[model samples]
Target: MEIDFAEYQLSSQLRGHEDDARGICVCDNTGIATSSRDRTIRFWTLDESNKRDYTLSKILLGHTSFVGPLAWVQPNDEFPEGGIVSGGMDTLVLVWNLVTGEKIQTLKGHKLQVTGIALDGSDIVSTSVDCTLRRWRKGQQVEEWEAHKAAIQAIIRLPSGELVTGSSDMTLKLWKGKSCIQTFLGHTDTIRGLAVMPGLGILSASHDGSIRLWTLSGELLMEMVGHTSIVYSVDAHSSGLIVSSSEDCFAKIWKDGVCVQSIEHPGCVWDAKFLENGDIVTACSDGIVRIWTTCHDKVADAVELDSFASQLSQYKCSRKRVGGLKLEDLPGLEALQIAGTSEGQTKVVREGDNGVAYSWNMSEQKWDKIGEVVDGPDDNMKHPVLDGVQYDYVFDVDIGDGQPIRKLPCNRSDNPYDVADKWLIKENLPLSFREQIVEFILQNTGQKNFTPDPSFRDPYTGSSAYIPGAPSKSSGVSKPTYKHIPKGPLCRLDVTSGVSPFQRLLGERHSFSFSAECNRHDFSVLCVLVRRNSSDWSASSGFDVIPVTGELT
Candidate 1:
C-alpha cells in the first residue's frame, strides 16, 4: 500500500530527560518506556480521551550510566503485568516491574558496557561491548559465549525462535541457542540496529549510512540508502512498515525497500519504534521524545498541508538586472565614412589614427570582420595604441556590445595573441571566427605537422600499458600513531585540543573549532563558543551556533 507522508503529524513531545534520550520500547498497547543517557527510564501512557497527549506515569531509576537499550517482556502467569529490561553503560542489566515501579533483578556478568537486550522464551539475551552474549533466566546467567570479533551493538529474536546479533565488526551473526550458525556480511561499518520482518527478512541499520535486508540463511537481499548519516535504530511493524532513526536527524519509514515517509528532528535521532497501533515514537539527542501518528480528520490534514506549504514557500526566484553602456551609444557614430558599395562592400569608420571596420558578405547577408581593426584611420600605422596597449590590430564588433560584460577583468599582457584567445573563448564567439582564430593562432605559433604522430599508439591495447611501476621501499619517516588514551575528567585542558571524548570513542574524526571564556574570581559563570566546519561533510551537516551562558562551578 502507498503511504502518504503528508498525513503524518507530530502528536506530542515528551520533555523530561536532562540528557539524550537514547532508547525506546513499547511496554503495551497504550504504554511506552524511554531510556535516556541521563541514567533513567521514563514510562509514558497514551491518554484515551486525547490520543495526542501522553502522561508520564513513572520514572524508573537504578542504572548509574547511560541507558542504551530496552526490551519489554510479555505478561505471563509469573508476572501478571509484565516487566521491562534495560541495559546500560554501567555494565549492568536491570529488570524492572513496570506496574510496581520496582527493580526486580540486576543481572551482571559482562565486563564492559551492555549494548543491547532482547526477550526470548522465558529467557533474556543481552549483548555487551565485552564481545559476549549472555542468556539470563530467573535473575541468573544461563549461558554465555563470545559472539563477535568486536563489540555487539544490537540483538533481536526472530519469529522462528532464532536469535540474531549485529556487531561493530560489520557483520551480523545468526545463533540457535548460544552457538553462532551463520554470519552475514555486506556492511563496511558497524551495525548499530537490527529488526525482524516476520516472514520477509531481517533489517539491519549500520554506521555506513545504509540499511540492509537479509534472509534467515545470511543472504543479503536488498540495501536501503536514504539516510546520509549513520543509522542508529530500526523497528518493524506487523504490516511490513519499517521505521529507522539516524544521526542524519531524520526518522524514515520504509515499505518494500523504499522510503515512504520522513520525520525530521532538530537533533540526532537515537531511536525509533512502532507502537502496537502503528504510531511512531522517536527519541532524540535533544532530550525530547516525540510521537508521530496519522490523523483521521481533515483538520489535521489541513494543518499538515499548511506546514508543507510554508516550507515550500521558503524558496523563491532571485533576479538581477545588468546595466551598462554599449559601443553603439558612443559619440561620433555619424562621423564614420563608407568606403565601398553597400551590397558587397566593407564599412570603415575612422576615429583618431585607427578605423572601426566591417566586411559585408552578399550570400549570408551579414557583416564580418576582415582581419583586426584598431582605433585609427591610417592603414599604414604599424602599431596603434588602444587601452594602454600597442597592438598591430584590434577588432571592434557590435555582437554582445549592448549587453553588460559578464566576463571578469584580467591583467593586461604584452602579447596580444594570448589576450585575444582568452577574450574570444570567454565571449563565446561565432563558429566562423572560432575556426579563423584557431587557424591564425596555429599559423602564428609555428607547427611542424598538422597530422598525428605515427609512433603513438592507443594506450588501452598498447604493450607498455600493462607494465607495473617500480615498487618503492618505505622511507625512514615514521607515521604518527595515535594511542588510545583513557578519557579523564572534563577539567583537563588537553581534552579540548583533539576530538571530543564521544567522537574518539566512536572512532569518528571531525573538524571543528571551539573557544571559551571564564572568570577566575567567579568560577560559576562561563561562556563557550563552538564553530562547526561542515563544508567537507554533507549539506545537512551544517549547524547553527547559539550562545549559551550558565553556572559551571
Candidate 2:
C-alpha cells in the first residue's frame, strides 16, 4: 500500500517490436506482456533490478492481420487456471493458459475484425468492426447484441453488470443485459478510448482532442482539454492522478483539474498506465516503452540542475541596480592590534603609538588593555619605556606562495655570511626557529631554484640555494587500467524468474597494480561490475573511485 515512486533513466532502449504494440497487460505476479502489430506476443518477467529481458513465449498465429486486444484473468480458488484471452482482426478470440503457454480454446463468432475487449467474471466481452458485441463463456459464444451504429472502437462493463460501448458514430451507448439502455450524444468526433471510475463516473477520450467525463446517468461532468492532437489512451490512479497519452508525442499527468507534469517522448505516446509503484509506463508509437516519475512538490528538484543558466538568463532581462548604507567603524574595534606580550595574550589599545604593556585579552572582542594607555612619559621618571621591541618584519613575510615539500630536518649552512648568522646558537633555543627560516626561503625561491642545475640562487636574495626536489607527479601511485573491455553486441537476453548472468570477456587481464594517475581537474571513468541479484547496486560495488592510469589517459 506504500506509494513511494522510484525512478529509472534509460541508458538504452530495446526496440521491442517491428510494429506498434497495441495491447499490454501486467500479471498478478508483476510479469508484463505486450501484443504488437508484428503478429506476436512478447512476455517479460520482472526482477528487483528492473533489467530489460523479454522472451517470445508463444507466437499466437490465429490472427490474420494483428492481435487487437488482450485481458488477463486472475486465478480463483475454485479453478487454479490463469489465462489470457485475446481478440484479433481475424475475427477470432483465443484463450491461452498463462502458466503453461498453451492455447486452451478458440472462440469464433465475430464476422469482422475484433477491435476492443474487456473481462467480466469468467466471461470475455468483445466489440468488433461488425457493429456487434459478443460474449464468450469458457470457449463458447453465449450472447450477441447489436451494440452500436458504427464500428465499436472501445468498450467496458459497469460494476452494475451493464455494458458501455463507444462508437465511430459519435455516440456512447449503455446496454443492460441484451437490451439497449441509454445513448450519450455529446461527442462531435469518433470515440477512441474509455475508462470508468466509480463515484467519479465515466472517462472517455476522442479524436476531438478532448477527454470528457460523464456520470452514469449520461450527464456531462467535465470536458478536459487533453492534447493538441487525438488522445489515444487514459488511465486513472487511486491517488486521483490521471495519465493520458496522445498523438502529440507526449504523455501528461493531471490532478484536480490542473496539468502537473508533461513527459516528452521521441514518438507519439500511444498508451500510458500507472504502475503499482506510482510510476507511469508509456508505450510509444516507435515500438519503445518508457517509464516516467513526476513529483507534486513546488518546483521539481530536477529543475534545479539548470538554475545557474536560468539566473544568467534573468540577468540579461534587467539592468543592474545597487543600494547600501556604508558604516564607518565600531568605537572600540578601530585601534585593535594584537601584541603578544606573553605567549597567547596580546595587548590591545586605541592608540597608534607602540608600547609593550601588560597583556590584554585578545580573545575578547573589545580593544581595552589591562593597563592605561600612556600618552607621554611619567612626570618623575626620565626613562618610561616599552617592555620589548615591537618587530614588524616577521609578519610581513608572505609564506603563502610555496613549493610544497615533505618535512625534513634542516641542515645548518657552513657559510658565516648566511642569514643564520643572526642566531645565538644557544642551548634551549627552539628548533622551530631554524625550520621557519628554511620555510621562508622555500616560499620565496619556488621550483626554479630547486631544479637540478647548479648556481640556481635567488635573483633578489642570493644568500642560499633551494633544496633538492622529489619527482613531479604522484601518477606512480595505485592505478587500474581498463584495456579493451569489448563493446557488447546488441542481442536480447531472456531472463526468467531467477538470477541471469551475462558476461563479456575482455581482451586483456587486469592485475592489482597500485600505480595511478590522479587528475582532480577532469572526471575519470569509473567501472562497476554489478552482481545479478543485488538488492542495492552499492551492496555489490560500494562506491569506489578508481583513478585511471597512463594507459587510460
TM-scores vs. true structure, each candidate? 0.55, 0.50
Per-residue lDDT over 1-553 for candidate 2, one digit per residue giving the tens place of the 0 to 100 score: 3344333232223246777766666555545566767776655554345333234454554556777577777776533656677888788888777666667788889999887888887788999989999888877889997788799988887777887899889888888877877888798888888877646877788889888888888899887785899888777777777778898866777666556677766566677766665566666666765545443331223443254235334432222111110011111333344344334333322222223234444465433445543334333322212112122122122212242222121122222113321331221111223324433433332321222233333222332322213222332222122122222211111112221111121111232234444322111111112111222445545553434455422
For model 1, which pairs clash? 353-376, 353-377, 354-375, 354-376, 354-377, 355-376
lDDT of 1 by residue, 1-553 (tens): 7654444677677889999999998888748899999999998987777666789998999999999899888887766777889999999999998778889899999899999998888889999999999999999998999999899999999888889999999999999876789999999999999998768789999999999999988888889999999999998988788899999878999888889888877678999998887888899987889888776531234565465344323211011101111122222324323223355454443333234455667676665555435333434434332332233444333333354433212222212223433454345432123223323323333321232223433221231111012122132222222223223211111222343322222222344334444222112111101212222556577654434344421
Model number with the top lDDT: 1
* RMSD list, candidates in order: 23.7, 25.6
Give all candidates' CA lDDT scores.
0.67, 0.55
User: Which ten residues in a row are the worst by lDDT in model 1?
Assistant: 316-325
The number of clashing residue pairs in each candidate reads 6, 7
Q: Model 2 clash pairs? A: 477-515, 477-516, 478-514, 478-515, 478-516, 479-515, 479-516
Error of 1 at 339 (Å): 65
